[model samples]
Target: MAGVRISRAAGALLGAAGMVVPLAVVTAAPAQAASCTTSTGPYQTRVERFLGRPVDGKQSAADCKATQKFQAQHGITPTIGYAGELTWRTMNTMLAQRAAGKTPNAAGKCPTNKGRIACVDLTRQLSWIQDGKKLTYGPVPVRTGRDGAETRTGLKKVYWRDIDHVSSLYNVSMPYSQFFDGGQAFHSVTKSMWNPPGSAGCVNMRVADAKAYWSLLRNGDDVFVYGRKPGT
Candidate 1:
């Protein structure tokens, strides 16, 4: 990753520059050897799926070249990394569009599979293993970035796991169970302020509800977080 001080996502979004979605035209020649698809990269394929297409899976030279061209046209620095920060920003912007009663740039919101992971707009949070057929916005109190630590909005995966209370890269701790990354988790936090959009990047929840969320999680549980600010 570039050591250059990349701006924290939240700040970038709140600024007047606003969020930029990928609306550029693809100009890479089909015959070019470059390829920068997500299929072979570490990023979740769901991102491409969310965008309503299948990535070539290999980051060919053509892919990189194409991406650079796309970035140059969009005025974004073309970096080669699956699910890069810009990708997250674009995804969030698209989600915001959807929340504003617009369909996502992609064809679907999320796949509806039984007991699968998903997000609930009514509750403004994500859920797991609840007969994914219906939306379950369990009243969990997750702390979101109030000062604009704005959580990346899009499809993500609980790729790793841990037992007992864990902490995030940000050093915030969650008591009594499961994985930690980026100072966030599907763990317990006080719920006195239910669904008020008051978290510092971690998903806050009532202790009891946290337990339910824990039980609901399994490695590879798909997670999606997106919605308008409460009462927008």
Candidate 2:
């Protein structure tokens, strides 16, 4: 502590003649919020439908206000009301979660022959466990990988599981992990599952869902992943 000296410009200066000189403190200003935009984004119609608004592709003042509010509520930065990629992706995930409702595998993309299998539909951001033709658990919301780090498709078996695992690479808590494909697994996160940019390839789930997964699934269980995540 004695050897560490604060420069005059950085902190209060030391007095040469035993007179103390005080420096005025400076602090960083808070960032200004983004203004709402009236521009129609590429996913305008989709955003409108998700918001329960008129499903027109045009962006009106009302639509802009609604979107801006939604973005703010969801902690989306630059909440400018544009139906951009991030906003649309978040909305899409939420819609999928709502629509799942006990029929997640209605399309039958996830093979039912595996006896008990965890099905991950990347397109709708939904995950559920099925036993033959019976719904074992879930139809819950999930957030998977982003653009370049897409969650691998096809069938994989759960190779490992940890109740309180920490990611060695990122040094973050990966609670209730059920590893299936390589480094990818199902884990719980503190943040919203639908938050933008997505995960590093693992399937992120809500705490409740992750805990349920820990209880329902075991090592060697089948995990089937299909479809393409909306943004990815």
Candidate 3:
């Protein structure tokens, strides 16, 4: 019979049961091939557990501190609360790289060799646009959300274009929408600039940035948004 697969948080319950019942510990899955220099920590451990790794005999306080430090050093502040969407997105990328068997250099940082993708650094609250070898867009500061209106973090393909911007539901036409989600979009906001932790979930940009961003794409452009930061 196969042993029950248990999550790290569930292991305690299973361990207690082992005292009264015959419970053979399940072996850990092989560590995914990773060349990252930073050691693992509580948050990473949680991520690993989420990825189906065992926490049985692996706990690293130093690694946790190091990981937290690494994040701070890289521009993400240490938030003691639950892992935010941005952190989770970064973690997912790190996990993917590790699973790919890539090795890190002596400095312990993940290679900056990830070609052309949007990576938002939450601490700096900036969006970096890359295309293969060049960083194309910005560290341009913009608003995100604070009232529980989180920016979506995932891959979304551009479907259509709404040049006259407004809540089409409201019959107000103003700017543009590449139309990633129903109403959520990237558009120009003449009202607010340099204000972060704002926006009702739409990525608001200045007219110039908005226009530039709009011009950079067409129908079917793949856009990956991560971190709840504003963008152009």
lDDT of 1 by residue, 101-186 (tens): 32221333555653566453322333333334553544233444333544456666664344344232223345433322333345
lDDT of each: 0.43, 0.76, 0.44
Better of 2 and 3 by lDDT: 2
Candidate 3 lDDT by residue in tens digits, 142-163: 4443345555666655555656
Q: What's the true lDDT of residue 104 in model 2?
A: 85
Off by over 4 Å in 1: 1-110, 113-115, 120-129, 135-141, 166-172, 176-183, 195-197
Q: Backbone clash tally for model 1? A: 23
Segments in model 3 whose C-alpha atoms lie over 4 Å from true places = 1-123, 169-171, 228-232
| Per-residue lDDT of candidate 2, residues 126-163 (tens digit) | 99999998998988888788788788899999866667
**C-alpha lDDT of residue 228 in model 2:** 94
Lowest summed lDDT over 10 consecutive residues: which window, candidate 1? Answer: 18-27
